[model samples]
Target: MTISLHRSATVLFQGDSITDVGRLVEPDSPLGNGYVRMAAERVLTALPDAGITFVNRGVAGDGVSDLRARWREDALDIQPDVVSVLIGVNDTWRRYCSGVVTSVRAYENDYRTMLAQVRDELDAQLILIEPFLVPVQDEQWAWREDLDPRIQVVRRLAEEFDAELLAADGLLNQAARAVGGAELITGDGVHPTPLGHTVLAEAWTELAGL
Candidate 1:
């Protein structure tokens, strides 16, 4: 769907490390070096005079709860014309790596709360990106039990909120299978490689009609 933005529109991207992509590490470049940047570049190139501003507030190692905790300051306060979220994978990651499980119910609850806040408080268009995993290792496949439910939650929430939904998981997986293996898609099972980032940016730009 093509989302209409007002003049001088500000687009904000929020999520975990994949979205972060070393934003804090390279403070001079707040947009980081990921799909967020690529998407912004594509949009600006298409509409050079549109006066669109892109902001990335994705924090590495963040979960849904972390987004909830900082939503007011990081998202709402920005008053963006569009808000894009790419989260949930870290929630699954933490469960396996640190035994800190965010149940499906809790994940939905937190996600809904954040979306509700955005709906009530802002006039921004919402883009809810599905948290994806490209399994390069044997054990990463086991994470599907946790991540699949969260992806469904995102889809449901997007429908509920009249938001744009990006089925990134399936799309990226298809890309992985289409040409190269999972390793070419992502170095690990979580973060995207440069090619993977391009795939995401292309999909996002097309979906948003940027």
Candidate 2:
């Protein structure tokens, strides 16, 4: 689906560490070193005069609730024409690693809340990216039980909100199978490697019609 972007449109990138990729710490690299940067670079290269401005507000360990709490400062205030979000895995990760559980109901609620605000306040086009896992270890497989339901929530929300959907999980998994293993795509089940970021960036640029 084409999520149209006008010249001088502002696009905001939001999510967890996958989107973060050390953006906050690096002064010169506000877009971080992940898909957000890659996608922006690709778009600029193709459309030199598009005048598109890209912003990354993803925090390393944020969950849906965290996004909701910071929405005004990080999202609405930016007044972006389009917002692309890649969240959810951390909600599941906390359950497995830190004993904090974000129930599926809560995940959907918080996410919906943020989207509603965006719709009401900004009227911006939305692109909801699927939170994916490319299991490299045995235990990571168990995360599917928690993460898969959230993925479905993202799909449902995209349809409900008339937003574009990117099946990042499906795309990366296909790549992993094609290349023999997840090692080349993602060193860990959650974070994308350089090649994996390229996959996400290419898909995002195409999806956003950038």
Candidate 3:
């Protein structure tokens, strides 16, 4: 199964700390330390002639607004053929913990605006990855109320933009149930462990149908 409409397209991953995972600042350093690297490696290995280049522009602790600010430099500049985004958890997380309130309306608006830019300016294929948090602790379980709507918004946007959707939240939830409820994966109920990253890579590969 092919993961892309174009076999040799460039794929770009964007979002917050989860996506960033300390990607090397230098151009020579291609893959990051997290799921991005794992997915890229698998793609390259499986489709050696596909010639897909993976770029991760996820900045640690970034919110949706931060992505908008750097979109030109980090995303559009690369001229990616397929762009995947996994953001919005930080928005809800900050509001839940730090009293840094970003309304759901604002989050949805910002996301739409950014996606519109990608559609009109770059003409790239979009992949909207739902932001997820496994409820390891009681407090974390409540995050779903706020985060779930945002995930729905991503689903809507993907349909509106004719982009592929990777249901990371659903995948993680299933994994948690199977693997002892998030303890086997996420370390802090937010960041994913290496095992969690492997799970994500497999999910992405399956979604891309590669």
Model 1 residue 186 CA deviation in Å: 1.1
Residue-level lDDT of model 1, residues 2-115, one tens digit each, is 677556999999999899998989988899999999998998898888798999999999999998999999999999889999999999999999999999999999999999
61-133: candidate 2 lDDT, tens digit per residue: 9989988899999999999999999999999999999999999999999999999999999999999999999
Measured on C-alpha atoms, candidate 1 has an lDDT of 0.92
- Give the clashing pairs for model 2: none
For candidate 3, write residues 1-210 as lDDT tens digits. Answer: 234636668899999888888675545555668898898888888888877778888998999988988988999889998888999999989988898977788888999998998999999888888888887788987888889888899999988988788888888878878887687778888788898899998878776776
Give the lDDT ranking, best first.
2, 1, 3
TM-score of each: 0.98, 0.98, 0.93
Q: Which lDDT value does model 3 have at 39?
A: 87
lDDT of candidates 1 onward, in order: 0.92, 0.94, 0.85
Pick the lDDT winner.
Answer: 2
**Worst 10-residue lDDT window, candidate 2:** 201-210
Which scores higher on lDDT, 1 or 2? 2
